[model samples]
Target: MLDFRHISAARRLVPVLLIALALAGTTAHAASGPGASSKGLRLAAMLGSQDAAKRAKGLSALRAWGQESLPGLLAAMEAPSAEVRRGAVMGAALQPAPALAMESLLNALGDPDATVRSLAAHTLARLGPLAATDVARLLASPTHDIRVAAALCLSRMGPDAVPALAAMMRRDDPPVQANAAWLLGGMGSDALPAAPALIHALDTDDTRLIHVIAEALDLIGPDAATVLREMTLISARGNRPFSRMGAAAAPTLVKLLSRPGTPMGQMALFTLARMGDQAKPALQDALATGTEGQRAAAALLLTGIDPNMAHTLPEDLRRTLGGAIHLN
Candidate 1:
């Protein structure tokens, strides 16, 4: 939430903090590491500025100190003034390795101010894997926004985040489950271990949850293919609607082309077309069968796969496939 005015104020306080740190026996040449620098002390002072504008100036100054301002910023986090503590947390997050701010950020997670907590979550999550531990801690936080921040961070972290994400899947809330499933899908093969659970999630009575699980299956890829195939078989054999399963299994539908006798092969081709060209070979195979439904679905998929492929179909086939091609 730091804005233009805040940035200007931070710039103004840099000089003051540097001078104070210089007088306080801290120095760039000292073994104690990055100290207050004139920038940090003045920035800390601004935290006590009675005027909102002056306070913004202080926060802005601290943020500007960046990594070199860490020692001072860390000290400021313990300030009795709420503004100073908030400013310190904000400044620390701006460090290149935000992991350095993990402790301070974690403490701020329980701040009485909702805004501070939310900002802390945003910074930690954006830091990616560096903030993984803190993000995991926040996953169980009572606040919804904190949980959301953790989920988003885990999603961005991809596969490395699956363990924590999977653990949270046991929650009763469908939205939480849905986000967890989506993140697992993004993990690609790393998420293979979670395939069975994800597949099971697709069967939830909630159609919305089914969509989320299906999307996860698509992301889990080759790892989930066998499970998808089995699901397809069970659905077809039982004469189930298979709508949600088919929709979710879009990516795996292509494999059906390799297993001809399974009713799923052609049936999957049509759905693959719905998913786009990854199903090209399967659709091509379907085209040859030329039964009205098979040819029609093939033509539709071909247009999506490649317009050139659609044009390549014989005049007779095109005429026979007219309605399916959707040339318009």
Candidate 2:
């Protein structure tokens, strides 16, 4: 009974109405949650987009989705492009609960690209103490770069890294020992517990290692005062094994005299000025009987701690220090 023209128009409009309804459904689904699998695929593709801006937007959206973004990011980690893999790692780090992506991040640590590996390590660090166990494993890797990256990540975890770093200090490998020392030093007073191990390592003949150990001791601040003073005295005596200890302690010693206007500062200055006298037996012995280099070293250190004593020095000792004593 309907007109042919009207029937033809209704048929033509049927497909257009169906398409609009489908788009509306999709829009509503996207608005509700990222639970739709298609939405996830689209986001993942966006993350791997060659355009940097699109990748950044995808990362932002994924972070907004929170835990919902984890699976897609995990999948993106295996993207053929190293760039996509790097982006995935970064996106994982930006999630509201980064620890949720820990497994994916741990796997990314062994990525072929160095930058990706480094980024993965840093991302784990951003997860804080929660990433400690996985990061600890990387420390044992035979690869130097991986070990170093792990050390850096542990350093960023603050006090939580103490146990792992303290253990590393005992390793026979010099680089391992050096990296551990550097991180411990970065911890400041928190690293006081590792002082004994660091002091023990100072027995090495490597000047580089010695320098790092001294720096670590210095960074431990007043907590290391007792050890510092002992090492300083030994170094002052011109002992070969502890030769570089004095130079290492110089900055910390000077800090003690920083508040020259305060009572504590006055005490520090007094103690430093008399350090030469306290070590007088060694100093005198060196000036009276040691070689030119030994006497020069002893006199120079003495003159540094106490300038007034310069007049009392023997002619030869004075000459060894290059004429009148001058403290830089």
Candidate 3:
């Protein structure tokens, strides 16, 4: 019954009118009560929309909601759509605190989608101690990637992760052991309790692991004295060549100046000199009774620790150190 030309014009105008209405509604929503709630609902609905652009917008909006939107975001993690699940996990990560979302994020670690699981692990790491309860479970995951993710997360948790990381040091898997050592080393003095396991791992024939263990020991700082003493005893007893042991045990080597100048002592002196003031006390003791080589080495170490101190050394020691420094 309508004219064909009029009908065609109306059809074209329909899309234009819809777009104008959408814009007007958005503006009105920005200025009214219940607007925020309506907008949140719209975004939440878009999370499951088939359109990728709509889903992206939804995720952005939810992230802006932060803690306020956590409940809905956590609920969305179980959505049938992988894209929606991904968006929800990301949105949950944006919360100011882990809050009630910790369990949801941990559960997401087992998401069927690898990307989602990885994002979940990264988010958990950001949550720090809020997610500590899952550390053991994540470390025990059958999947290698998940284990790696857990280790990486623990590495950033500082002292709080010491117990879990120390336990991981004894894992039969070489990669797990290596990662634990690396993380413990990065934790510095906080990882002191893990020293025994790290020291024992040094006996392994695995050359690569030996380096990691040594670094962890070094980071355990002065508390490593007992292990260092044992290492010195082993080296002196000819259990291992000095060359094989000197570099890893450098921090303790300075303390051994009271002993005779073996190859280990020579290497220790060299190592100490390179360590600056950390070696001062040991170097001073070396000057008191060390052989000419040891005294010279101590003087040279003093030069690096403090050139003024080196100049103040007894004339004879300075002369000897000067001659040896040039050669070194």
Error of 2 at 93 (Å): 1.7
State the lDDT of candidate 3 residue by residue for 159-271, as single tens digits. Answer: 77777677776666665677678778877888887776765555554546655666566666634345655554433434454433343444345444423344334445555
Report every candidate's CA lDDT.
0.57, 0.60, 0.59
Using lDDT as the measure, the top candidate is 2
Q: How accurate is candidate 3 locally (lDDT)?
A: 0.59
Q: Please list all clashing residue pairs in model 3, or write none if there are none.
A: none
Ranking 1 against 3 by TM-score, winner: 3
Compose the digit string of candidate 1's lDDT tens values, residues 1-328.
1012232343335434433322332122211324564455456556444555655555455444456677776677666667666556556655667677777776665666544554455556566656665566565566765565455446556666666666656666676677677667767778877666665455444556655666666667643356755556434434564533443344344334333444345446545655565456646665665445555656666777688787777577788877767554
Please identify model 3 stretches exceeding 4 Å from their true place: 1-68, 112-114, 158-160, 170-175, 186-193, 200-212, 218-226, 229-328
Worst 10 residues of 1 by lDDT: 24-33
- What is the TM-score of candidate 3? 0.47
Highest TM-score against the true fold, candidate = 2
Q: How far in Å is the alpha carbon of 293 misplaced in model 1? A: 19
Query: Per-candidate RMSD vs. true structure?
Result: 12.7, 17.2, 17.3
Instruction: State the lDDT of candidate 2 residue by residue for 167-277, as single tens digits.
Output: 777777666687778878889999877776776566555556666766776777534355654555435544455453443433333333324344323433444445545
